[model samples]
Target: MSIHPYIEQAIELLKAMISIPSFSRQEGDVAAMFEDFLKSTGINYYQRKGNNIWIRSKNFSDQLPVVLLNSHIDTVRPSSNWSKDPFSPYEEDGKIFGLGSNDAGASVVALLTVFRLLEEMQQPFNLIYSATAEEEISGDEGVASILEEIGPIDLGIVGEPTQMQMAVAEKGLMVIDGIVKGVSGHAARKEGVNAIYKALPIIEWFKNYRFPLVSDLLGPVKMTVTGIEAGTQHNVIPDECRFMVDVRVNEHYQNKELFHLISQNVNCELKARSFRLNSSFIPTDHPLVKRGETLGLRKFGSPTTSDQARMPFTTIKIGPGDSARSHTADEFICVQEIIEGVNTYYNLLKDLYIYPV
Candidate 1:
């Protein structure tokens, strides 16, 4: 009638992490908690500016390939619909509820446990464990800042809420601001060219525009006109119209290529608000992916973007919990999911080997 040590430790660590409200740019307290845990475990780690902590096994040799295990320690602000306090950890029917319990707390502890287990074995590749910060907001002080210190990472397993499925491809993100200009005059007399009218064609183009290239896994690039503004008063015609476009890009096209496609087709001035989030993909024939296949993890294209998009190296997204449960009113992770996560992670890496072709 006793729980397994891995489950007990993972649950305890997840509870401790969820007890602290580490929202977006504020992960100081949670980092301190992790520092204490690491100290008690007698593990060496490096702390980046925003509380991003990472540790590499002392047993590693530069001659071997390295695999990175990473997950964020931040959460989005809780919504108003929660039944209990967001930061307070609560358990019911084998589930743990809190702000970040599902989004990544489950993955963090699971990976930490896996990292500890792997340290005892002589593996074919080096292993690096990371609990990064500021992932919710795409902040500069998070994973990107710590990679240089960790050195080169040939492959990575970026953890997120995926129900232990393998996210082989993740979509990229881009936002654009569009401007349409015209002369201003009285609206009643129709004495001037209306910027809003000029913008209509551009907006319609965005609604119907489709990039010819389609990814076998991710399908197509999706574009949406999210916002628009024009006209100050009903009595006068507006000289300028402004709008915003949100694009989810597939791996087949880069952000810049999508930008060019938009700019070339639309007859309006355009400015890119963001273009850095690049799509990520791993071929089915990849050794890690093949290993995952043997372990029975389903492959899917993730429409949602994760820290994987920011990684310069190839990465696969797999973890506990449900993506639907993330950023919700009563966010939670099932006890079963956490245990499954530990097993899945272990199975995926247990027989991994990286060699030059």
Candidate 2:
């Protein structure tokens, strides 16, 4: 089958974006490129004090609810094992292969295509296109700036790769640190209480810790120890040891409940065991899901966490490409999937705002 003209336009745009390596905080160049695209299309937009760029639709009116289309411009660092040049976009078979092909770049292109189509049709809706930065580590710096300035909106669509599925819910993320303290002593004496040894109980507790199997669109909560550091050297008993824990939580469990549960299970002899919890976001069964389904898009929940967990709007993770290909050596997105995503998003906007009953 021949490709649609809009899809072709999107393909060219995606290639242009993939050529620029917008890795995390280094999104200045790509953001500028997006700004140029907006200006060329004659869309009204402005850059925030930070690197984020916001594009507003000319159809903004009092009757329509403002819709925000959000996607990050940054991609994770490219691995050395990539068979093709990471920054150089390439098309093989039916897929577009590049560094950010699957993670989020596909969604970025889809948004661009959808907006262009909307502008062409003179669609009636208050739309905002946001290209954010620093989403890999935390979205606080980038997204917070937008929220602080623009305030809240009616709804938000986060363009993360959901394999053409509408992700109505996602698990929250919490980063915790465990510190164990013990007495230091020489290896020859071997009389001091080893902090490393004290950490054993904590490890055991973590191993046996039974996370509640709560059923939701996203599934059960999970906990994992991401990093551990204890001993100083072979000849000394280190007095301090620290480990990091990553937890993906469901809506049923709040941070306070989980923290109290963990503290209760931990023994008191490990000195200080503290945790730092971040804010959580939950997705609602908004009208957007029905709109997406009407456009022939699949509906599902996200297994992994995204920046949507930090936003307070009725957030949904939906976009082109597959999550399995994300953060992999040969990351790629089918060209057709990108095209379908653009049409789907266009239809969603039409149903929700342009042609709403």
Worst 10 residues of 1 by lDDT: 41-50
How far in Å is the alpha carbon of 5 misplaced in model 2?
4.1
Candidate 1 lDDT score at position 117: 86
Residue-level lDDT tens digits of model 2 in 40-82: 6565456554678776666666676677788888889988899
lDDT scores for all predictions? 0.89, 0.74
| Candidate 2: pairs in clash | none
lDDT (tens digit, per residue) of candidate 1 on 1-357: 575686687798899998998988799999989988888777855455568999888788988899999999999999899998888899999999998999999999999889888888988999999999888988888888888888899999999999999999999999999999988999789599999999998899889977899998899999899999999999898999999999999999889888998888988899997777889998888998888888888999999988887788889999999999999998999998998899899888874786662
TM-score (C-alpha) between model 1 and the true structure = 0.97
* TM-score of every candidate: 0.97, 0.86
Off by over 4 Å in 2: 1-5, 119-125, 186-190, 211-213, 233-238, 268-284, 293-297, 353-357
Residue 335, candidate 1: how far off, in angstroms? 1.3
